[model samples]
Target: MSSNSTPYYFVPGLSRHPVMASIGLLGFGSGMTGLVNGYSWGAPLTIASVVYVLFVLYKWFGDAISESNSGQNSINVDVSYRWSMSWFIFSEIMFFAAFFSALFYARSISMPWLGDIESKLLWPTFTAVWPNDGPAGLVEQFSTMGPWPIPTINTLLLLSSGVTVTWAHHAIRENNQKHAVWGLAATVFLGAIFLGFQVYEYIHAYRDLNLKLTSGVYGSTFFMLTGFHGFHVFLGALMLAVVLRRAIRGDFTADNHFAFEGASWYWHFVDVVWLGLYVVIYWM
Candidate 1:
């Protein structure tokens, strides 16, 4: 094939990766269901399935990387990848929307209805508050987390990481490998620090504040939002680390760096979601 000429679309041959991935996911799902139902080997099975899934992804994507590096990927292939990634992100947005909607319904509708005039006639002492001790005192009288020190610090860390990732992207565009590497390293470090603070915050919530996943509506929403977001942060950090590895190996150039760009997009999406969490979950 010519180095720079119009060419036929690239079509990858069928492989066993997809079947292996599906099997891994099935095992993971089965394990999760078993764990929820109190099976003895659930957790270990889940871990194993997770490891298998990761292995499959590494192998599958490694092939794609090899194809791209070999100049086998055409313009159509690049566009297809972009479209696929965009749709994937859109799906994620919808996932979070469902959770946020649940939070709204609980706080705005369910709580109010529970404490309404008719409800008071039935319960006699229930009060309608945003973060009350929940109906029948089922939830403990615990304090909610505020957007202070730890959360604020985490916010800063994520924001700074966003900036650093952007710097890395810019550096890559300019073909400044040294600056790009440093920027990616900084982003990874900041993401790790953010995760560390999150763990400490969770400990504080459980031990000091008496807040937990089972602590009623407030606790449930709190954990669901922040916990899922933390998981995303972890995934995003992992994606960045992979990109960094590729960069160190001189895989990206000014013209072909969608791997870096895709990871950056996911990281920025993560940052924005955290900002929303800070405002709605912590500050409000």
Candidate 2:
């Protein structure tokens, strides 16, 4: 392609980013394994690996952004990005589906089976309750998490963020930079607040309610679902923040704004996952 003409497809040159990223991940995995096995250098290795990963991501993303800004990304590239994101979100759905299925099995299948007459004969005092501490009473006594102030508030916050992110997408399409920035900012703010409330909820669960990870099936499922969701929210918010920065810098135009759209898609996916969690984990 000529310097003045857009390429049919932008194929980046072979780079060291993939190798560096793999090394960083390997180090992180090794560090985590060491930490679990009580190795002395685990903490330092983990921290260093995290820093290395972040640095590599920074450089890698910067290069991609530069390519986009230079008009190297064609329409074909945009379509590929959309399809890639769609498949990525579909995989995330499956990830959560596995967790939800575990919850279902524990609640609807295994519990009832254990409560049956045949199983009950083995342990006369055991009751197969939803939040039971196991037949042997191995888990600690704990209260269940309810859909109250914090959880309900978080649900509302995520729902509202969905709206705000959609509004930002509309604003971007209309070439209204100011409104887009504001909308993205509001979405990020709401996500941050939701995370803050989640932290408080976890603290309350541990300190007051005594609902911990060791509280048997209920506690483990609840924490696994909500904790993973919270992590996704953090990532979604971070992506929105980056998109917001780009918006403020007037990077996107009415014709081209896939970065903004991609971030919004992820944020919306996070919102949808939270809704499912609220219904299944909290209400059910």
Candidate 3:
């Protein structure tokens, strides 16, 4: 540990991580309150909240980076820290898996049963349709989305982004800095374009097809799954953008590029989730 740092290898001071985090959450909650309340200040409230949260995250991660690069963090500490982060990411995956599983079961088993002998009497007028069947309780009509155009394009975009990130990883390993930077730049651009197209799709859904969060059971699960996955995509893209900036400054070496790898894995996970969503939500 450094003379300025503590025995546990952390910065020797009363950390503001907790207090700052609380403020960020409070800002977010207040902003959500305004949004749900549908007030004039709702947009501002949410904007402030997002800014606060981003600022807090910046400071939190910034501190950790300083702690690591300042020689206070040992190799032993780094290994242990990596294990902890791995398990944490695993837990996050499990959390999302539960949601995805519920979505699967609801669409496959529950919806089918509702239109069958188990609840046929209850839903006397409802037909056993694949797309519109919401749940056993609320039998509403909703058009199912096909994997013909928008979804297929999105899937391809994510797949290509994954390939580009992998290329960047390879370039870094080979010490081809220019190629790696180009790859990162391309990945980030593709990610941005993917988001833009997804937004266009959402608008098309609301306008032409009348698909939305309140349309039916299909709409609910579809938005939840795809929306969350999109948020992850935003995060992955942001991370990749930052990595590109770092690469421009020669901040990372081939042997110590865990930051780049982490971003790649995260983007791949987002891609995988989108694939599952495409099959279950759009295809079946």
**TM-score of every candidate relative to the true structure:** 0.94, 0.92, 0.85
C-alpha displacement of 222 in model 1, angstroms? 1.0
> Model 1: number of clashes?
0
Error of 1 at 86 (Å): 0.7
Q: How do the residues 70-150 of candidate 1 rate in per-residue lDDT, one tens digit apiece?
A: 888877788888888899889989989999999999989999999888888878988898897876877778988999999
Candidate 3 Cα outliers beyond 4 Å, as residue runs: 1-14, 29-43, 133-142
- Per-residue lDDT of 136-245 in model 3, one digit per residue for the tens? 44544445667878889988998999889999999999888999999999999989988988898788877777787777667777777787778778988998998898
Per-residue lDDT tens digits of candidate 2, residues 1-284? 22313447777899999999999999998997786578999988988998998899879888988888888888777888899989998999999999999999999999999889998888789888777888877788898889998989999999999999999999999999999999999999999999999999999999999998768899989998999899799888988898888899999998889888988989988998899999888888
Model 2 segments more than 4 A misplaced:
1-7, 27-48
Candidate 1 lDDT at 174 equals 100
Flag clash pairs in model 1.
none
Which stretches of model 1 miss by more than 4 angstroms?
A: 1-6, 36-39
Top lDDT model: 1
Report the CA-based lDDT of candidate 2 relative to the real structure.
0.89
The best-first sequence of candidates by lDDT reads 1, 2, 3
Q: Which ten residues in a row have the lowest lDDT in candidate 3?
A: 2-11
